[model samples]
Target: MSDALEKAEAAVREASTDTAAVQLAFAAMELAKAAQQQAQTVPQHHQCEHQHKPRRSAGEWLGIACAVCVGGVGIAFASLALAILGGTAAIVVLVLRSMWTDYQRKGR
Candidate 1:
């Protein structure tokens, strides 16, 4: 019974050693293959070619001009409204400046 036990223990140790050696061999082969592939690959360079587009149509330009005119009128009306509210634009500016200063002082 003791002899059988000793044989089983030796067999287990031999199998473990064989498995470790096989793993090391496979790892070495994989490393060599990777190195070979890295050495063989070459990088590529490319140049970009950009194309220019034509200008907008007259209708499109007119639309943009109209939009700008509308924005200007809106700004004018807003200024007028602010003036009528306090009888002067300076009052609105002073109020805005004071609010900003207070906000800054509060770290908000």
Candidate 2:
């Protein structure tokens, strides 16, 4: 099916000398090997007839929002207590923002 293979076959047929036939055979083998390697290295992608995943439900979003709000309120009270006891509120905000950014990136 390959042009190189077709050309090599033609060359072999036309070759009068043993050396010419051997050289053509070697060329064809190399071409076949390269093609095989390419097939192995390249990932084969198949298209789906539909979407990969169903959309998230509204109830799921509401539940997630509720959990987040509860956790956030708890953290705010904890961080306030820590700040009152001479801890750094700025560091808490920085760490929480960094974690949220990482979570957003991973979700995408």
**Top model number, TM-score:** 1
Clashes of 1: 0
Question: lDDT tens string, model 2, 1-108?
Answer: 699999998888777577887999999999999999987887556535675787889999999999999999999999889877665667788899999999999999
Global CA lDDT computed for model 2: 0.87
lDDT of model 2 at residue 44?
56
Lowest-sum lDDT 10-residue window in model 1: 42-51
**Could you tell me which residue pairs clash in candidate 2?**
none
Quote the positional error of residue 65 for candidate 1 in Å.
Answer: 93
Runs with alpha carbons beyond 4 Å of true place in candidate 2: 1-51, 87-108
